[model samples]
Target: MSSDKPQNASESELPQAVPVRRRRWAPSLVWLIPVVAAVIGGWLAVHAVLSRGPTITISFQNAEGIEAGKTRIKYKDVEIGEVTSVKLSPNRQSILATAQLSKEAADYLAEDSRFWVVRPRISGGGVTGIGTMLSGAYIGMDVGKSAARKSEFTGLETPPIINADLPGHTFFLRADNLGSLNTGSPVYFRRVPVGQVVGYELDAKGGFVRVSVFISAPYDRFVTSNSRFWHASGVDVSLSADGLNVSTQSLAAIALGGIAFETPLADNAGIPLSDRNFILHDAREKALQNPDREMQPFRLRFHQSLRGLSVGAPVDFRGITIGEVTAIGVEYMPERKDFDMTVDIRTYPSRLDTLSRGSRISGKLSPQQLIGNGMRAQLRSGNLLTGQLYVALDFFRDAPPAKLIVRKGMPELPTIPGDLEELQRVLQRIVKKLDAIPFDNIGQQANDSLKSLQQTLDSVKALSDGLNKETVPQASKTLEQLQQTLEATRQTMKADSPLQQDVRSAAQEVKETARSFRALADYLDRHPEALVRGKEAQP
Candidate 1:
């Protein structure tokens, strides 16, 4: 093979022949740039597709504290999304936030989910959100998944109003002041927290205020009766020399603008309780329900001089509060100068008896029965140290107190007799009778009579008592001596021997004579017509 191949030319002969035309990059290098660009573009596209998520638009009245891209969406306090874009709404009215929600939280975006902004509340009642004093502000939302619901959300002007879903139609309550009541302040029934404050508003009417409450399911049924939406602020009252004062017993319920109701239990009624969620969420659609007829506004009048007493004071009957004082006003007609308080009371008549659930007059109980076995109206001291008075209902009969009534210049409600008042009246009557007496004459006569009577009685008692102790001993000794003298006289008469012998001789003579008389008496006894009797025995 080596012999067959011809020897190559000198070293430079082969390749130095052609300085292979080199390709240029400024032009062809631009093609390489295209390849690099393709790789970068492909990377960006993959990232964009994989990180894709849903866009949720939330509109707010103001975006004072919320930041676009910084705002987060949450469900049950868990962060599920972040805002991506911020812009005014199409109407140029609201701060529209375009947020990207994590897929994990999307399922919770329910049709009934709610969104609101938390802020400080300033009112005459009191201030709320001490947190806002430091934490600035944030958005609170209840998430739900409902494609049917509007994808857009409008943040509430007021904070979220937490309330218990009640039975029947939801009530509309408006107040001028909601106090420091929070979104989740517990609503109570006689001090028992049964519901909570859910949200509030500056009423669409721009007047008064709107409060949203969440009544629990069973408690919602209690709302079968209309409830009073009042302030649950401070319990206030004043006590003075004129009379007892009281406030905020049952009316304490209104202090916080909470929900309270009386539900009548039944054996055959349909499910009267409503679900426990905001009706505005979805239950609003089913708000066409009729309320129970038996649930009526409890009525009571505080016919008294309510000096310093407020309208929202509690009205209790026998310690069990049945209502509250809604309006404290006065009527100037008929010379009956009185401050009459119109009360909004609530009473579940069917609940009067623990055993009876149905409404029937047959089960009507007497006031006394209520006091001992069923019910009692206790006039409670709203503030014992304050001497504020209120009414409470319960069963306590160990004490049968006296009734109450008006006296002096003090204006009083026609209250059921309390133990205290009855005692007062009796004392007053006795004092009046004593006042009617001529004290000077009676006192002198009584003094003289008491002195003479005491002396005479003392003398009689002393005479009888001393006779038994002092005179009886001497009388007993004299009687014993007289008995001994009689015995001695009888023994002396029998000691004479002549007297004994003569007595024997006479006895022998009398015996012969007695024999003859006996024979004669026998003959007379045979003669039935003969009389043989002493003068006294003849008849």
Candidate 2:
């Protein structure tokens, strides 16, 4: 009731006028802490999304030394990425390696980019990746110049011979076979290694093997249009007209094989185009031989054995090689009732034309005229040690007259017997003559003669013995008597011998009588009466 009544106006107004004022809300430091932390966390999330790189998968025949989360991809020994995982392919035939690369390596992932597992290797280019033996294997990278990007790739089984970044030129070589050459096989210019074989494949027709090679610059410029390439593998040992020849590029070529090229000094060498195609010869001599412009086929019929003579045997004119034997066969001669060896040969007339520049022939004589003038072919020994034979063409003034015969389409050239064959014929004739002699009859006659001689010798010996035993003593006694008689006669003829005195006295008496007769004759000449007188005295 007192409230309802009008109270004291000042007390009532004082109680109503005392209005309550709400205190302003105050902030805490704890709220500021959570707001700052949220801003930092947002910045970190955006940075992580921007820093990640592209992922790539590579296929390999095998993952021999590859490791996940451990092996790294390197370019020129610089780390560019890492292998994250390894697994088999869907076909279960190959291994697939998943790698994460840095952003800088994204451009290197081109269509032609090459990758290989680096391990210790010994090849024609020498030993490489030895450092990887201790550090473990890694994926090697070679960046390509292709503009198109790729995420999947097939890795190389072996490292590339030359890096893509290396300045060089590529060329193609065609060969009959691959020989001992392989990727990374050395290529030489005058035995100096200037390049390597990068790859090889068979031709579309499968008739030949085509090899691709890379020549480093400076040396690449040396390969000209006229340059000749040949296999320098192992040792080339040949016996030709020049004699035995042994050649090789290097010791490496003997083991791993190699190739060599050279430009002839006589040829003008122009710059070669990129990817130029050239023939790869089997030997250096064949590569350097001058091309023959003219070939003439001719046939030769030999009546003797063709042993030691081969199809490629040289056909020589005097001492110069002018052709080669192309074919060898046996043909039966119906007229002679015997078999004759037929040899087809190819002769280069251009070689003779060049050699006859200042000679008397001067390439003017025809084949018919040459054959008419005593030209003939003969087989002779070329190499005594190898028992190799060759056809020799020369003038045979004593040979029987023979004409060149053309049968069917081939012209036949005349042939004379080989020296050995001629000698064999002479020996056979001598043997036949010797065989005609009656050796057994002659031997019997000789034995009879020896018996007669022995009888005569025995008779002579018996006679001599008889003379020694009986006739010799009788002859000695006769000789002694003759000697005594001769001594007596000698004594009788001495100056004091009685017979000599008698002869002297008789001779004196005869001389006196003759003197007396002479005196009487003189007296009778003076007187005729004295002729009748027996004796007359001289005055």
Candidate with top TM-score is 2
TM-score per model over all chains: 0.36, 0.67
Candidate 2 Cα lDDT to native = 0.90
Q: Per-residue lDDT for 258-301 in model 1, tens only?
A: 34333333333333434322222101111222332343233334
For 199-257, candidate 2 gives per-residue lDDT tens digits of 99998999999999899998988888778999999998887799998999989888878
Candidate 1: where are CA atoms >4 Å away? 1-44, 118-138, 145-147, 163-186, 199-212, 217-255, 264-539
What residue runs in model 2 are displaced by over 4 Å at the alpha carbon? 1-51, 177-185, 199-206, 231-248, 266-269, 298-306, 326-344, 358-378, 395-417, 424-539
RMSD of each predicted structure: 16.1, 9.1
TM-score of model 2 vs. true structure: 0.67
Cα lDDT for residue 225, model 2?
78
Clashes of 2: 0
